[model samples]
Target: MKPGLLALVCVAFLATLPPVDAFAAPAPSLPEAGYAPLKMTIGGETRCLTADGDETKSWQYVALKACEDGSRLQNWKLKSIGNARYFIFNEYFGEKRYLRTYSKASSIALDSDTSGYSTMRSWEVSNGALNDIRLWNVYSRDIGQWKTLDADPQSQSVGISIPGGTRVDVWQYGIDMPTPQFPVAGTRKILVMATHFSDETSADSAPVRDTVLGVFGTPYYEDRSARNYLMQASGERLTPNMDFLDEVDIGERPDACNASQILSAARDAARHREKNPQDYDYLFVSIRQWRQCPWVGLASVPGNWVLAQGSSAHKFWTWTHEFGHALGFHHARILYGCPPRDGVAQLGGDCTTYNYGKAPTDPMGGGGASMFPVAYQHFAGWLSDADVPWIKHDGTYKLDPLWRRGSAAQGYRIRRSDGSVLFVEFRRPSQPFETWWGASPYVSGVTVYVVNYAPKARSMTSTLVNTTPGSGRSMGDAPLLPNHSLDDTLSGMRLTVTLAHNDGAELKVEKLPK
Candidate 1:
């Protein structure tokens, strides 16, 4: 090729090569960026950094106090001050006033005294030991001290300190979430198998398969029993694949009808089949007779066994309720301890089993007639953000019945600044379960509950906010009706149902002044 042509080609190729950093966007500086607020909990209490005493005080000592939702005093604004440092400002106060530590030993205080940004008023946030979050003091510019927001053990008040191993629980206050567990996507297939001993005739085994298929496979569960309605409302769909392995000759033994024996036989039979055993997600075993058992089913994690009997043959809610366990449902007992009712003595102590045969509105609590509570629905991944809206500010909202499919919100979650939450929903008596159980006037209405997420203990407590003072069975299922308002004076929130209907309801919520 000619020298001029070669030179031209090389020049064109060079022009085509992109310049350095062509696709890169400039990173924003921290000082110019904003941050979300943080809720800090220590010593099992939610604490807010406060400018204690008169608001007009120039240098009021910053102290810890009980966290209150929507309280400007409890809301701390974290502002970036460049180079991994942050200035914590109390929203209760206006501009420039920031939390500052006067000396290493002095109590933390709020001051507008600084003419310019001070590193002594800045802090560094980082992960600490045992999953705890730590904040470091950037005052000396040496990163020397573990500055912590501490709370008094007795009064649960907050202050600044060089913390020891004590970990501070830090999280955003209003982030709503579902219960954490293994999730089942799409529709799940459940296998129902009926077993017969060597001595038993095919005639005796007929009831087992007949009842299993009739109850689970047909509309008995889906429409008539209200099981599928409950699950589908939560975004879980289950299809019962009834496989009647009638009169499988398990060698004679008195314990053959036991739960373990039945599970083993069913597993063996499934493995021996041409189809792979793992194809089935659940195993339901049925026997001929009953020996005065609880007339319930047993679930061993992913595997579930239903001991169906003639007495409770048509009461299929028992089986459906047990399968709820396999799907990762905890008993819908009164999550928090409930006080005495009608001189019957208080039941449900710290979630311990006390009130069985109560709570007819929840299947987990011997109430086969009622649907699962919003708490269980949230935990079971049934209520998505679309269904349950988290209310960050005060507003009037419309809600549909939790079971009905609609574009409207089924529930509203009002999160207190302290990380507690209020869940409001509408409940009614319409399903077959409710009709069969004779809808309790107390349960068929609107409901409100308070959920306390205890970080230190790694547990959640759900307390029902009663509608009729003490009319509910155990944890109380009755919801407040239209034109009725219930107030949580502590959280400064009032929920009033303006209109109630078979399909939905409208709620007017007011964040009352403390």
Candidate 2:
């Protein structure tokens, strides 16, 4: 055979074989510098990333919308600027605007500038499971940590979130998904596990076990336990069953507070005893005091796990507060520093200061192990719709003590003009719990709270209206006493506590002329 014919035969054989790079590692499916829909699958439905309102406008809201083909607002342009960072822009508006995140608001919006490093415009894109991708703002990274870009399928909104647990969903680029649903109701099983470090020989398992059982198992209504507090707070909607796992030694020296490692060990120990941790709805881990940990108690927001360090696990306020977080509740906040008209601090005025866990009558506010505020109870779906009616007309309504089950109104919901809600409830000193140090004027009065309904918000969503502002009074005295009135200029409504007694209180809701 001729030499040229033999060479041609070799070339033909090489063409018949697969490409070399195909056998090598497949290139990452992450978005390159191109146009595509940033999609996420939530609740079995596909939602496409979309910019709300005018595309050319700056600071337009960004969210996930129903997937649609050929929709300009749904299409995003990924422009790489090296180092896995990208400047994302809406294809409808081109490069004039880019996706930006506001850390304070935990929101994503469109911006015009592209010069800042990671302040807003720059986003770091990394590969997730399979075709999924995770986005983090460089500014958040510079601030020591970054939250995940999470989506609420029910609300059709997207925001930055730090999940309460190890599990989280990463956005899937170029993939389509559907919408989703709600959480479980009624009885939820709770598992309590105690752990101690190898160096802590003084850590006793007996008292710790008793404390755990007392906090969750005690059935007496007068007992200051999470079970009793939640039962009253939930109006019997939620009944949590408590299960105790024998204490385990994690065999680790507490050099630093590593929650993940501690929780993993506790879960493994439960499995070793033929108990599956996943069988319970909530997991509570109690650990001995370690100086290395900066926090006494910690819990995942809207998550199922809670960690309590030291003797705090035994305290009613500490463990109950952590459990509140697991139930999807944020801290009860007090709004301060507002100009006072008459006697009340005008909440509609320029109130800038906010103090968390300052409302002294509610457990979520770091108060005694009392029932949660009316707003939180309402959020938990514990309040009946008939009991908490929306105030539409000016009228006097009787509000029973928030902790008691009664025929009178438990709370009132007033919708402000800006779409936010104002919840009004009466509080009185109850037995075992709701008994703070100063119980005279603070614990027994009509309390009002402005609740912003943002399901994905990480900050304090409820702000207590300070009835007695600039009086050098603490947050404990924030509730409106009998015969006192509050004029909320923002809501165009005036609330006056007409009468008060041991049974309940009378509130007058009058609408101001617009």
Candidate 3:
């Protein structure tokens, strides 16, 4: 055939094929450029991908090393090349070198060339199991070999290999992570911005403003208000000073229940009123409930913003619970259907499932107008080392009510054999706020929780232990009454409540037989 005829035939065949981008995966949402650490757990220990040197070296091998704070070698930045593909750049030498796999070697190394070898430097990223990520080299796809970035625990080396055999290393990246903001002993200024759609302006905004003021400004509801709840919960360690911005009409209805759009409009309205939203520690946006909005209240986990709709803005539990999220508290969940005697089994049993927002002893669990639990308080840095002493040996501990003022051992901590922690606290109904406990069985008793301090296990951080497994009662009746005991067979610990009174309770912690 003639050359012109052959070229024309190829063009016709190419036109019939799909576009090159048609097979590309959807791009993930990531920042244009930020410092991130690729983390993976290997051999029951957390490790991070490191550049394997103190300085920039050509062909420096990449390996999995123990994660360290302020380790520039482990810090990486992803440069997007579109289509969910990125060039991994190391931040140790100011991002001068990027990651590349050698054709003859089974390991990945740092390379400085960007003018050529596009496929060698490009990587396709996707979401993996439970907040992890999977990275596949684009060069492997060109060679018709599907391989993912894998780490070898024996060699501590990283390479591209087929997944799902004996290798189980899944990488999770933390990009521009925020510093944990614990509600310490200080006043946090809050800016409350009330907004409504143009169609919903006929309703009175005064009630909303009054509700905000009552919840955060004055003690309108006495101890039930958010201000009072925080003050008592933190033992006056944290307080709120709120400034209310006049209600603004957003001019149009939102297309859906988009929190970002609503929050942006609220912030813009605050700026119009000469109030900078950044001046306050928290930005609280209140809006009327709409049909599209599914949540009554929403908040950024460990962030400085919260949003409330309609009656949820007025409800005490909603206000405190959402703000509690802003203060870095996960949902106070309960473990159900697990063994009552073994705390470790209760935490890790495959048959057991968790119920969120069910721990009726704390506000984070949607318990009506109650203070934060002792575990949460300790996490927030509100509890001192003396307040929650670690019980290493068998002894009788005199515990005070968590809500009371005096510092007489408000809570006790026990280290389990599996590296998890057990937090034990005594609870009694405080006036005005904890009135919901009056009708519940947990009004005054000893409560225990199993806390896992792993970073990836955020959802199961603090779980309320069900003391009475077959009682057929709600989690509200989970606490141990007077003269009752809890045996943790996995931890070899037995906790017995020897005495109970209005002032406090006495718990005898003993080591059980192996």
User: Which residue pairs overlap in candidate 1's backbone?
Assistant: 64-158, 69-417, 234-382, 360-367, 446-479
Better of 1 and 2 by TM-score: 2
Maximum-TM-score candidate = 3
Output the better candidate (2/3) by lDDT: 3
Model 1 C-alpha lDDT per residue in residues 128-162, reported as the tens digit of each score:
21123444555532335545655565655456566
1-514, model 3: which lDDT tens digit per residue? 0111011001000011122333122333334668778898887889988886745346677888889898888988877665445788988865577787656324567877565457778776654333466777767665656578888777767877867766655787874221111334467788877788777664455655565556334443364556667777788877778887666776677788777788888887788788898788788877887867667777654456778888677765677777766555666667555454443223234324464536777666656666777877765657655678777679899988876857479898775645456788887766767665354556567888877542211112577777764433257567777677777654567778887777888898888746
TM-score of each: 0.56, 0.62, 0.63
Worst 10 residues of 3 by lDDT: 5-14
Task: Give candidate 1's error at residue 139 in angstroms.
Answer: 36
Highest-lDDT candidate: 3
Q: Which ten residues in a row have the lowest lDDT in candidate 2?
A: 5-14
TM-score of 3: 0.63
